[model samples]
Target: MTFEREFFYDEVRDGFYIPGIIKRFWAYELTILSEIDRICKKYNIPYYADGGTLLGAVRDGQFIAWDDDIDIMMLRKDYNRFAQIAQKELPEELSFNSLEVNQDCEELAASVGKQVVGFAAELLRKYHEYPYAGSVDIFIVDELEKDPEVEEHRSLLLRRILFLIEAIEKHGKSKAVLKEINEIEKIMKIQFDQRTALKPQLRRVMDKIFQEFNGREGDQLAIMQFYAFLGNCKYPRSALDKSKWTPFCGMQLPIPEDYDAVLRAEYGDYHKKVKGGGGHGYPCLKKYENKLKTLMKGTWDPDYHFSEEDLVRPKIQNFRDIAISMAEAFKLSHKQLFEDCLKGDISTCISRLSRMQEEAIAFGTAIEQKKGEGTESVRVLEEYCDALYQAYNALSDLTALKEDGIEKQKQTEEICRSTDISSGLQKELEKIANTLLYYPEKLQTALKKDFKRQVVFLPHSMKYFESIRPIVDAVLKAEDMECKIIPIPYFDKYGDGSPKEMHYEGDAFPKEYKITDYRTYDFASELPDCIVINSSYDEFNQVWSVAPSFYSKEMKKYTNKLIYIPWFVTDEINPHAKEDEKAFINMEYYVTVPGLFHSDLTIVQSEEMKKAYLAKIEEFAGKDVAKKMEKKIAGAGSCLLGEKEGEGIQNVVDCFRLFLEK
Candidate 1:
């Protein structure tokens, strides 16, 4: 179970260095792969390296530098036999996670059509100092219709069904959700209970559909777990009917005899190197190391141990500490204020005093609950509060004197210098006030509950309008929702600040949906509940940049929520694969743009893409910001898919509602 192989940094490819940590991760995964190979061989079962793992073996003769996991596929029959015995056959150090062996893995099991039997080293912590434990993803390849059109039809049907199953699990069996499920069942000529564990029943139906073409002649093969758009999942039966052994990470591994065909089908130009980590991110093993450590220690909790209300007392103490600092500063300024007006320009002092007054008012409102308690701290705070009010009046009087004339200005300056206000007092008071105002309880209570929520869609160009259209349509369908489609202007950047050309596509919106002119829309005054913008790149876009006014940071001031949805879609990439990483890096300009970094939430096309966006964001913006952005990035399947297939629209709508509810 222990990996004896010592790892070190080495240049596996030109200019691509595999660090010791990643090398160790690869060794850990290879151990699991070797164990799987042993079990398959003992049981006389057949499996072949799939996806990025296969690509790496054939193209690189080892694990891809950026790839962090191993993937292997088995035909449906072999997969079933292996699943039946893998748990008992695996060594004590290794454990298999699947629906049959562990119900906790049911979601993952259902997502991948049948089961994704993840083999992990249970004694990893006991054996290794590094907390990370890598796994081998076991996928089941199912048979599909031979004809391309029929195969597409079957794939689409299964995709829609899977989407509904996910929706049912996420949103519960809402009436609309159930209706969509029923429509799919009717098409398949099947029936299931409308209530009482619909998810499991839908999963059973999917299983039935997956095996429909099994045991039939002239059937094509496909991995049904991934999105159909991935393009590389489908293959000819002959692709895997024959097998050959290949060197992978210094170990001989099983690969399809027609690996060229399989790799080509999955990744065109398989020999090319691209650098990007998998959905789990670069060095994906460490992504969940902490969570696993907690679980292993039996310290993980499924619920919050403390609530926001519980933080109120601690926040009050924090505010008091800040108040104490401000009060000490006031003690020094108090004598000077009585003797003279202030030391600086009357206008600047007036501005600071005004801000101090606002902070005092806000702090007073925040501490209203403690007013009747008659605490000693409260009594002292009241005294300083009064003094702060008087300071504001004194500054106002100096402003009035300055407006009088030059002689008045000289007198004001003398008065100010004699007063000598403590410059830091204003900052301290503002800090204290903000701490109180942003208390979890205060923020929770301040949430707006409007009768009708307004969401404004700002699409910069007609070409990418479809990206936000599904969300717009979903919002309009809601009884309590209203929206405006405001197509903003953009310019072709010409290296200089000046634009090469200005383009406005407001008129390009479909006649059915009214388009509001950006000039006419009062963003600051209207205060839309949510502002959805499709454009992410601002000034960084080389070819085109949206008008600065529509940038996420600026629009945030005018809306309660700012949502950024990508204007483009991409095929699924192996997050751990170096080749995929390279592709993602090429897209860094668009993926890590300001809109994504600044927005309250970003809706990506799929979970795989979300990982890419997050990894790149972390790489560019740093881990702290990426961690915060994690909750903000959601993978609601792309609307472009629905547009192309004329389905999955409801699924996309349901995903939007799910994220918006949060």
Candidate 2:
């Protein structure tokens, strides 16, 4: 089957744009997904979209805008059965890669199906004009013992074995690496001949560890070897025991029966549209694009020998390259450390910081060891090292305070236990310690000083602009807040892949409001503190749609908060009244659209309207999500009605001020 999708350049994450090449890469991945779906149907092997792919399916009804790969999981038993028959069932264009199928493969997880051969090659050439191979990552969900301690031990052993496998592949079975592997194997109680390939040997040990708890009765299951250290990766066995079909792209794909619980467990606030780059860097096909093209042309050699430098780089590189690498590593590590801290994973944060310290020291020593470097270069390197150390010291202090906070929380719990307070009162005290003391203090410590937060307004049309004008005016007058009104372009989408015509509604906006040109304003770099949007239909609107780049989900990544202000206000409709209930039910199409679903906060016209919106959301998203949306959906009173009545405008202003302060 031919898989062709329209490709477009858009901002996929904050400061990260998806080039046309990445879109083509996504098309390649979609082809692989389709093939997998076909084989699974034919064989009756079960699979559910895993990780980011599942998040995308549930949230966007397709691939995550920034994601570069598709991930699916099968139970260990089903996975083994699929692995046995996938190659035979798959079309000529696709080839499944696993240790059993390709022993040289170094991946800990098996099954990178669809390597862009035969039909897939011709399809890409015909549609995308670029023949690039893409694969669906197949993860195995293995059963875990109910005991937390035993599960933890298994996870640790699996991680160590996986690490050694990676080290062997990268360092070529060096004595140091092999020594580490030997120790891990002894602990795993698996031994192998010295002449056997180190990579496959370690993988076998991992497989043994993974299968140890399989077939035994257990209530927990985990996606093996992928983020195994994360406490939330394990799930209740019931979460995946049954499956239901959900619309993904254009196909119905199996999802966990308890998808909501699974998503919530994996991502604390799964509904919130927070855009960030995936583990693999942006434009994931860059390294393989040329190689695939050459392979398609029959010039690529399958078994090319590597030069000495290719096998392993020198211990010390040129000063410039070393400095750049160190800086990049520090940035990535620092970002990850803060993310772990925010997730309340203090141990992971500390462990990452310790690794960063070691890396910093190594870099500093390498700089010192470099010979014939100019005095100026030496001075700069020394200065850089000093700054790095100072930053590390500050982070160390912050982590210590976080640890102290945890101690204080534990002490508070103990005090409550010792007292005559009711259980409810004890719970209240614990909550106070966590919300009022711990999180706020940690955030305060990390807050940067003397920076003006950017608040951007993206109003697609003149009518929508009027809906949010009051809030925009309030933000402009607020001190220490920078406001930019960037009116975006929309389109009249035909049912086909292309739009009928592009519309620039910004031209109709009042001339008094400062409008930044959509072409010039950089959403990624500005990284607005808050992004206010009036339109949210995205591609769902057949008549009039905002450009894909301006979708609320896309904007959510560039800003800390994506605030949605409804373009129209309705009179209060009491759900209790039959006529009003019917009216409210009919309004579901407007109330439960993507814009509101993806927004961080949505301000409705009045308290009555907020209830109406919540009722519709509950009907579709379930009661639990509706409960969470209570905080997200606010009643600010209509800006349009407020202006006409000339009284409730202050309420709108007050609401905007409260959100901005947070």
Q: Pick the candidate with the highest lDDT.
A: 2
**Candidate 1 weakest ten by summed lDDT:** 110-119
Residue 203 of model 1 has an lDDT of: 59
Rate residue 444 of model 1 by lDDT.
Answer: 21
lDDT of 2 by residue, 1-662 (tens): 34433343322232123434455556557667778888888888889988888998888777775566788888989988889988888776568887667766766567654454333435645434334556788878888887878878888877777677677768986888878967876775767677767777667667667778888869888876754656665678899989988887667778898988778877879887544424333344544645654655864422212122211212222234335445556666666755554444434554675676576556546545643333333444354445445544544443443456878656544554465645544443333223222322222222221124667898877766878888888777877677899988877533222465787877777777888899998776566677888775665442346888998668776665778887766556665665344345435435556677667788877887788788877776778767877888888886877755444878877887788677
Quote the lDDT for 543 in model 1: 37
What lDDT score goes with residue 537 in model 2?
A: 60
How accurate locally, in lDDT, is each candidate? 0.62, 0.65
Each prediction's TM-score versus the true structure: 0.43, 0.44
Residue 221 alpha-carbon offset, candidate 2, angstroms: 0.4
lDDT of 1 by residue, 255-358 (tens): 99988887877777878775543433555544454455465575432111212231121111223333434444443433333222223554654455465556
Residue runs of model 2 more than 4 Å from their true location after superposition: 1-16, 116-121, 125-130, 166-172, 277-279, 292-662
